[model samples]
Target: MIIIGERINGMFRDIAKAIREENGAVIQDWARKQEERGARYLDINVGPGSTEPVRVMKWLVEETQKASDLPLCLDSTNYDAIEAGLKVCKQPAMINSVPAEAAKMERVFPMAAEYGAEVICLAMSEEGIPKDADSRVALAMELVATADAYNLSPDTLYIDPLVLPCNVAQDHGPEVMETLRQIKLISDPPPKTVVGLSNVSQGTKNRELINRVFAVMAMGNGLDAAIADACDEELMAAVATARILLNIDIYCDSYVDVFMKG
Candidate 1:
């Protein structure tokens, strides 16, 4: 599974403060920690709160690339910020996303294809997030079609099925699995499936427990990646174990090395 560390985002209070204060050391420290924790891509979100997202994102991407060769997931709702980060990135990276909305695709997909950057497509459109599995699958198909029109291969896209909080939706777990299964069925060669695994646990008391359980369940339903806290040793261990059990890893060597090395 591809682990995209979802730390270093301006959404977090401390991280937002760090960026606001131009604390390069704090951001660099996050980059190093995620890399050391086996993250394949470090997700950097210079969110709405940043006064200068383009400048901050560019500096963050450059500084992160200098510290490690691991690719980055440039995260922003702002197209300008995305472009700025892409300009300075040293390796093929991911765009944190484009919604299934038409305007979003028009703005982001062309840039993604032009720069050879992979994209994450959310299974939600301007109509808003789907309430059922079939609608989610339909939105994913729409995203795939949009990418195809740009000559982007399915492998270059990551589909996020928009996992909602279990507190609000009691059947959130099954709905996510159903969406994953439906997406796999729709594509001849399926795009990599991912989710914000922690989202399912939002508003819940037992966050870690719920996150691990949902992560394992999602993997079973063909999820190939996730935006997660890579620094959580136990949660990462659960993911590694699930991957090994699913035969996604051979001999458990990769899993063992990821956990036991320290």
Candidate 2:
């Protein structure tokens, strides 16, 4: 499974401070730490705090690249901010998202194609997040169709089933897993599946435990990637173990150690 580190986002106190202070040290430090902790990509978000988000996005990309070579997942609702980060990113990056909405698809897909970046397609539309797997899959299909029209390959599109907080929407957990399973059948080669894994545990007391269990279960249901806390050692270990059990990784006594090392 691909792990995109969620630590560099400005929503976190440390990251928000770093962005505000223009402190490259903090940003670069987190970038290196996430890379060392087994993140395949670093997600850079200026969050909603920045007034000059485009400039901040470029700064974040530059700072992150200074410490780690891992590609970034440029995350922003602002199209200009995403494009700014894309412009400065030395490696090909991933767009954090475009919804199934036509206006968004028209803008983000072309930008992704131009930059040769992967994209996360959210399985929600203007009507808001669906309450069931079938409705979410319908949006996923529309996302896939729109992306195809812009010449974006299914392999490069990550379909997010939109995991809601389990506490508020307990029934959504199974629905999300079912959506993950069905999303894989949407096309030949299919769009890759991902979830903002932390959302599963949002507002919960035992957040880590919730995230770990849901992550493992989601993998079983065809999750291909996650935007998550890569620095969570126990969580990563659980994921490694689950992957081995699923035959996605070869098992060895030291498999967890080996996986962490990567």
Q: What is the per-residue lDDT of model 1 for residues 83-138, given as tens digits with 9 covering 90 to 100?
A: 99999888888998999889889988899988999999999988888888988988
Q: Pick the candidate with the highest TM-score.
A: 2
Local accuracy of candidate 2 as per-residue lDDT tens digits, 125-151: 889999999999999999888888889
State each model's CA lDDT, in order: 0.85, 0.92
* Model 1 local distance difference test score: 0.85
| TM-score: model 1 vs. ground truth | 0.95
For all predicted structures, in order, the TM-scores are 0.95, 0.98
- Best-fitting candidate, measured by lDDT? 2
